[model samples]
Target: MVTINLTLNNFSELPSLLDVFGCFGNDYEYTTRGLLRRKIPPVCFICSTLMVHNGYNPHTKEGPGEINIGR
Candidate 1:
C-alpha cells in the first residue's frame, strides 16, 4: 500500500478552498508509480488532512502561515 505522509510544523492556517485548489497547481502531479509529488506547493499535513477529511472540500477562509508541500 502507498501512503502519503505529511507533517505540518507550527501550523497556523485557518484553511480555505483556494488553498486546496492551488495545492494542485503547476507544481503537483500524479505519477504512474501511484504517488503524488509536488514542488513549492502551499500545503501542509494539517491542511492536507483537513482536505482529505472533508473529501478535498475545504471551506474556511483567511489561511495563515507558509504551507510547504511534501511527499
Candidate 2:
C-alpha cells in the first residue's frame, strides 16, 4: 500500500492527488470551515470508502484536517 501526506494550500493541488489515487469520481473543494467536501457520486463507492478510511466524514464526505491519501 502507498501512503501520502498531502498539504493543499490551494485548490489547484487537488487534481493531482485525485489522479494519483484514481479518485476522479467526484470533484472536491475545501469549505471555509477548513473541511474537505466532495460530492458523492453513485460510482464513487471506492473513492468514498477510501476517503472514509482516511478520516473523512462519511456522511458529509468532508474532513477536518490536512488531506492524506493512502492505498
The lDDT per prediction is 0.44, 0.49
> How many Å off is the CA of 18 in candidate 1?
15
Per residue, candidate 2 scores C-alpha lDDT tens digits across 1-71 of: 32334556745776775566454333654445655545442333545344442344445445535776996
Q: Tens digit of lDDT per residue, candidate 1, span 1-71?
A: 22232336313432442354444656665454545665434444554533432234454455644677996
In terms of lDDT, the best-performing candidate is: 2
Prediction-by-prediction clash tally: 0, 0
In order of appearance, the predictions have TM-scores of: 0.22, 0.21
Deviation from native of the Cα of residue 34 in model 2, angstroms:
0.3
Off by over 4 Å in 1: 1-23, 39-71
Predicted structure 1: lDDT: 0.44
**Largest TM-score belongs to which candidate?**
1
